[model samples]
Target: MTVRGAGIFGLACAHACATRGARVRVIDRAGIAAGASGGVVGALAPHTPDAWNAKTAFQLVALLEAEAYWAGVDARSGISSGYARLGRLQPVADDRALSLARAREASAAGLWQGRAEWRVVRAKAGWGPVSPTGWLIHDTLSARIAPRAACHSLAGAIRDLGGEIVIGEGAEAGAVIDATGHDGLAALAADTGRPAGTGVKGQAAVFGLDRRDAPQVFADGVHIVPHADGTVAVGSTSETEFADPTATDALLDDVIARAVAYCPELAGAPVLARWAGVRPRARSRAPMLGPWPGRPGRYIANGGFKIGLAMAPACAGLLADLVLEGRDAIPEAFRVEASL
Candidate 1:
């Protein structure tokens, strides 16, 4: 089936579909990664302990699937977007939050069991040094991706596989997979009557820090991810239902301050760029991935929100499985019928 809206998810879906022996045509309103997927950093952190059941499961499956997908990309395409498995560090500022973090870690042990990539690290014991107040939850499953490079590489892979990509606003396709993040969903809803998904605006910045100064990935309240270009990405601000895609002064200032606080080397680092984009946030944090409820031959694959980058491969794989191979189960948490 031909796929429309060749953003990360769309491109991924097209790739998976073609690999499964389907003729795929990917269409996009703008060039690839022209939306939220173009952001500087794509942190692949799974949900913290506070995440609900469905969201957490969705994140876990996505992380696992992405690891394999990225490894394949690294071998085949040799496009490395600074992908790394550096674990996440959550710092605590208050006593209450500390207690909550500990409890969440305990609870996650059961939920994350059999998932060998995640573990709880005691202070000063495992992996890296832990924070004094907060417990270090080490998730080897987590990864980082250069958003733009991953998108470009995925699109290139799809083309190399003999799939066609048409760049324009209105293009024809056998089936339209609306993976255009937040900005492209409204028009998709208008074209097909699926409820318009909401948007969550996020702001981020890139700093040209010395590579020797920072780890591949680190996170406290904010995340700092190292890129291949001797730079690190720091972000991000979350706003519900916001429209503006330009990074605000307050947000940029806050990210910079946080980056400097996390790693002093960034104190005088030169700012490379600042950007903001809206992720498609569904009513449920889980992605909407299935044939549009009422629209024939049209599918919805947006609403991945903050975790879009982490979840893209798994989500696309499941969608392809359903669309091309007639599979019924699609990562229990991300199944569209569950939300419906």
Candidate 2:
């Protein structure tokens, strides 16, 4: 099968196809991770308690499967993308927040496999060493990936497997996987009759800080992820319906201020770089995967929103299983037909 668009989802599909004994060719207009996947830090945390049952189930399986997949990739070939299971911390800002956290803790414990790994802590007096005035739920299941590096590694793996990756504009293929992200469906003309997904712009900055200065990872409204190169990645702002992929001063200020507030060590960090990308967010907040309703041989695995990196491995596996092995059992939430 010929796969077009060698982004995260496309490359993942290509890898899966090659593994499943299918001849594959991946084509992309721009380089890998050129869309939302190009961001500095890609968090692999799945849904919270707010997600629906089907969505939660899919993410749970996907997250677990991705752990094994990344381990395999790391062992067979070195992955320099700084993949770390640093866990996640959802702080309780207030009393209402604390209640919500408690509920989430209960729900997540019941749903997640490693229940004992999650803990809820109380806040202390001072903010320095003291915790917030809420609960701290630390789940070991969450992970992080250096987006660009992972994308490069995946592309390299696709080539290493003897699959072809064509980089040019307006390339053609027998079957195309629209993993180009926010730009993907638009590039494809949306002839498949599926509801066009919405775009959300996110801006983030990479800061060069001492290794000891930054935390492994801290996420609230904004997230801070430390890289192996003594650089801490801080982001991101969610702007709905924004098409421009350029960084803005307002976003930078907000993120920096928030990052320093969350982690005081980064108060005076040197800014390295700043950029932005548009994420394809599905209207129903679920990914669309499978062939175009009426257009045969064309498939879409885009609209992963902010969790594309965490969700790609499983999504790709499912898509390949459907296309190659004639599997019909897709997670009900991710069924493209429902959205169509």
Candidate 3:
């Protein structure tokens, strides 16, 4: 099997196929993790446990599968992908939000089926954003992984499994899967004569702080992910219109400011890195997975938008099932026809 784009999605798919005893080859023009998957912030968060739907249910399965999936990658590769199930904390700003959070605790009980807990609890020191209500939505389902390291880790795992990743070389052999991210989305839009999808630029920053094993904090619309490498990542700016996809500017500074305001403990931490990338957003605003329309021997695995990393494990598994075993377990909402 052949896969295009050596980012997280492609690498994950390649690795999954190899683990299943299929000889795989991955082709990427810019090399591994050169796209949005190269970003520093890796928040494997889930949707609210309330208002459950197909998308939310799918993501819940993915988040739960992450621990073992990443652990397998780490074990095979002997490299750390900085994955940990540290959970997440969200501040309760007011009584209204607190009431909603409490209500979701009940919903999570039924929806999560005891696999994880999404409960309302008192805010813990240095574990979350300041809660005006002194309450927080603490969910044990959330996790984190270092995005860039994860790509390399997956690549190494594939190599160890006798799979190959060629940079700007090799022809598509057997089945061809396109996980080419934003570039793939653009090509699809051009070929279809309509907007299939577009890229949204996101900017994020890393801070020099030792806060590993802490729950990720989401407050004031900013994600504060504490990585296992002892550095904290705070992000991001979702800009649909940006002149430069890879340039960090005042918007990033504003994001950093917001992050600091949310977590005062990070105020003194020095800036470690500033990064930006474009995330693929399909017209339907959901994952587009299935055979490439009007193109035989081709498949697409793009349009992950904001939740690409969180969804990668399941996405790769489903795509591999379809491409290799001819099994189609892709959710109807994620089908390419849905996006079209």
Candidate 4:
């Protein structure tokens, strides 16, 4: 099978197909993790535990199995994806938010299938966010993976599995999977003469801090993810309109300030890197997966949006099922037709 784009979606799908004994080839004009997947922050955070549905359920399954999936990639590749399931912490801004959080504890208990817990706890110092309400919601389901490293790890695994990765261009052979991300979305929009999907620009910064063992923090819509490589990443600003998708500006400065404000311990950390990228967001605001409507032997795996890294493993599996085994296991909400 041939997969287009070397971002998390394409690489993971290529790896999945190889695992299933399918010879695979991946073509990416830009090298691995050359887009959103190359960004600084990698937060495998879960959706709110309340109001559980197929989408959230799908993410849950992915988050729960992420450790094993990434570990296999790491083992096969002999490269660490920097994956860690250290969970996440979110500050409660007020009584109302706290009430909702506590309520979700009940829902998460049942909805999460006892595999994880969502509970409110007294906010603690050091490795935590500032909470005016003195409370925080901590859930065990959230995890982190180094975005670039994960893609490289998967590439190595694919190579180990005897799959081919063609940079720049390659002839299309066998079933074709278009995980081309933003470009694919743009093509879809042009094809339908409607906004099927578009790029959402995001910016983030990395800090030189060894908080690898700490749970990630989500405060005031900002994510502070601590990777296994001793660096902490904090970001980002979701801008639907931007002059330059790859340019980082003052918006990132604000996020760094907010991250430091949320976790005071990061006040003096060295500014390691600032990065910007565009993510593919479908019109349905969910994963866009399925065959091209009128194009046989072609499949799509895009629309991961803010959750691409988090959702890649499970979404890749579902796409591989359809492409390699002729099985359709994708949820309707995540289908390409949904975007159409």
Candidate 5:
């Protein structure tokens, strides 16, 4: 199988196919992790436990399946993908938020199938986001992984499984899957003469805080992720209009300020790296998967949007199942036709 675009989705699909005894070659015009998947902040957070639907349920399955999947990749690749189920912390700003968290505790019990827990707890000191109401939502299902490292590790695993990652374009030798992030989605939008999806630019920054063991914090529309390398990541500014997709500026600084305001412990951390990337966001704002409509021998695995990393595992599995075994377990909402 030839997978185009060597980002998380493409490499993940390639790894899945190669591990299943299919020869795979990944070709990307800009090389691996050259898109949004190469960004610094890698949070595998799930949607709110309320108003559960197919999209959130599918994300739940993917979040639960991520640890073992990435662990297998790290083991086979002999490289650390910086993957850990460290969980996540979210602040409860007021009574209404606390009430919702308490309600979700019951909902998650039923929805998570006893695999994970989402409960309201007292806010911890020295770490975790400060809750104005003294309560926080702690969900054990949330996890984090280094995006670029995970891609490299997936590439390593693919090579170990007898696949190749090549630079530049190549003819499709077998089943071709389009996992090209923003570019592929844009092409689709142009070809269909309608809005399929567009890129949403985001900027993030890495901090020098060595809080690898701390749970990721999501507060004020910002994510504070602690990587395994002892660095903390604070991000991001989602911009639909940006002149430069890869430039960091005041928008990122604003994100850092918000992170610091949420967690005072990070106020002293030095900024290490700043990054910006454009994520592929479909019109449905859900994954656009399955065989590409009206395009024989080609499939789409794009439109991951904000949850691309969180959704990669299940997306790869379902798409690989469709491409390899002629089975389709994709959710109705994630079908390519839905995005079209």
Candidate 6:
């Protein structure tokens, strides 16, 4: 099978195909980890458990399976994906949010299937977000990973499974998949004569910190994730219109400031690097998958948006099942027609 694009979605699909005993070739023009899949802030967080639907349930399943999936990849490739399930913290700003957090604790207990817990707790000093209500919503399901490193590890694992990765150019072989990120969406827009999806540019930064064990923070509309490599990743600025997609500007600076303000431990944190990339976002605001309509032997796997890493495992499995096993388990919301 041939998979185009080497970002998280493409690589994960290739890996899944290879694991199913198919010889696969992954082709990419910009190469692996060069897109939003190479981002710094790799927070594998969840939507509010208060809401339950096909989209939220799909994400929950993927987030729950991420640890073992990444561990298997790491074991096979002999490269660490830098995955850690350290959980997450979100501050309660007011009494209204506090009430909602408490209610969700019960909802999570049922939704999470007793595998995890969501509870209201006091903010941990020096490492937690500032809580105006002196309380935070802590969920044990959230985790963090190094995005670039994860991609490298996944690529290595694919090779170990006898999959070939072709950079620059390659011929299509067997069943074909269009897993290209933002560019694929643009191509679909042109091919279908309609808006398929869009490229949403995001900016993120890594700062020197060693709180690898601390829960990630989501406060003031910013994500602060700590990795195992003694670095904290903070992001991002979502821009739909940009003249320079790869350039980092003052918008990222404001994100950093907010991160430090919410989590005081990062007050003096030195900015190690600023990074930017364009992410594919479908109109449905969900991961797009399944066969391309009117195009036999071709499939679509774009629109991961910000949760590509978290969604990669389940999405890949469903895609492989559809492509190889003749199973059609993909959610209707994730189908190509949902966005097209």
Question: Candidate 6 — what's its lDDT?
Answer: 0.92
Tens-digit lDDT string for candidate 2 (58-125): 77787777666776655544656567666666555678767777787777777785532455675333
For each candidate, how many residue pairs have backbone atoms clashing (under 3 Å)? 0, 1, 0, 0, 0, 0
Q: List the residue pairs that clash in candidate 1.
A: none
The alpha-carbon deviation from the true structure for residue 59 of candidate 5, after best TM-score superposition, in angstroms, is 0.7
lDDT of 4 by residue, 10-68 (tens): 99999999999999999999899998999878999888987778899899999999999
Please, what are the lDDT tens digits per residue for candidate 1 over residues 188-268? 556556655677788888888756223344556677777667778888888874546665668668877867775665777
Q: What local lDDT does model 5 show for residue 131?
A: 85
- Candidate 1 weakest ten by summed lDDT: 121-130
Task: Superpose all Cα atoms of candidate 1 onto the true structure and report the RMSD in Å to 1 decimal.
Answer: 3.4
TM-score of 5: 0.98
lDDT of 1 at 179: 71
Residue 172 of model 2, lDDT score: 60
- Pairs that collide, model 6: none
Scanning candidate 6 in windows of ten residues, the lowest lDDT window is: 122-131
lDDT of 4: 0.92
All models: lDDT?
A: 0.70, 0.71, 0.91, 0.92, 0.91, 0.92
Q: Total backbone clashes of model 4? A: 0
Candidate 5 achieves a global lDDT of 0.91
- Candidate 4: where is the Cα deviation over 4 Å? none
Error of 3 at 220 (Å): 0.9
Q: Flag clash pairs in model 2.
A: 5-27
lDDT (Cα) of model 2:
0.71
Listed in order, each prediction's TM-score against the native is 0.85, 0.89, 0.98, 0.98, 0.98, 0.99
Per-residue C-alpha lDDT of model 5 across residues 59-120, encoded as one tens digit per residue = 88898889889889999999888999989999998988888889899999998999999989
Q: Which residues of candidate 3, in runs, are more than 4 Å off?
A: none
Question: For model 3, what is the error of residue 209's alpha carbon versus the real structure, in angstroms, after optimal superposition?
Answer: 0.4
